[model samples]
Target: MTTPAVDADSQLLIHRCVDCRRWIHPETERCPECAGELKAEPVSGDATVFTFTVNHHAFHPAVPVPYVIAIVELAEQPDLRLVSNIVGCAPEEVTIGMPVRVLMEQRGDTLVPVFARA
Candidate 1:
């Protein structure tokens, strides 16, 4: 018998501080609050664009010009937010409170979290 494959949605795990009820991003060594050991937990993929900026200037040659990067507030916790990009739409279209969902991008051996319009 073989174990079933886990979905891409399952791979976007984040840690939440039990004592302070704060969510911590991946690669964090210590909890920003309560100074407790953070544990991995599942999160809802739903979020709303909290704020964003349209960058038309590229410092790197590989990156395209005019892209929108945003900080989104998770539906589960309004205070818990993540930095993601708004894709599949024009940069001018991104606005605060725009609904978005998580998408994964291949970064070497890791799947980095990104977001697209919902």
Candidate 2:
């Protein structure tokens, strides 16, 4: 089993069950429905803002205040959602059901998935 692949344009890491064809997040070793093997794969960056919040309080020095934190539904699956920041635009411009695209950002040792207006 190889490690997951990400960091490409319009790519987000997801695990797909080989047997059931179900997409899983917070990854599990096997498919809960079929007990099948899982494969790490990249999904198209297309998504929609399901919900969001604008943080006005600074929590970290490097992170600026008034950032948009959102729950976005991936285009691959109905319930396939992830927590990500809305970027490449202002926080006030974000809205529910707004289309967004994935963009990877380097934070420390990890590549974080962020979204921008599509």
Candidate 3:
């Protein structure tokens, strides 16, 4: 099967290869390992903070300083992770192995998934 283009709604789904059971992020047409068909699957949205950094500089004018940018590992599989912002708490409070859950925030027309302390 062909991989579909990721959009506002589809971003909630994680693509995986049916044959090899390999997870594909950012979406892809074919499985890199086994050339298997890929399918979009829903995740539980539970994750843990694998690592993070508190950015003190504002790269954009509207964004506040000292926001936590973290790599959170999903509960579904090991090493399956996404880069997202840690919310619902202070940036300094975020730590490695911290439990988190996904929360969708409306950004423009899209709902961006962010992690928050669980």
C-alpha local distance difference test of each model? 0.75, 0.85, 0.81
Which candidate's TM-score is highest?
Answer: 2
Q: Candidate 3's residue-wise lDDT over 24-115, tens digit each?
A: 77566898889899998777788999999999998998788889988888888898878889999998788899999888877777577888
Displacement of the residue 88 alpha carbon in candidate 1, Å: 1.0
Off by over 4 Å in 1: 1-10, 19-21, 26-33
TM agreement with the true structure for every prediction:
0.77, 0.88, 0.85
Q: What tens digits encode model 1's per-residue C-alpha lDDT throughout 1-100?
A: 1111125564567777777767776436678767877776777778999999998989788778898888888787757787777888998888899999
Order the candidates by lDDT, highest first — what do you get?
2, 3, 1
Model 3, global lDDT: 0.81
Give the C-alpha miss distance for residue 110 in model 3, angstroms: 1.1
Superposition-based RMSD of candidate 1 using all C-alpha atoms, in angstroms:
6.5
Which residue runs does candidate 3 get wrong by more than 4 Å? 1-11
Candidate 3, position 32, lDDT? 83
Looking at model 3, report the run of 10 residues with the lowest lDDT sum. 1-10
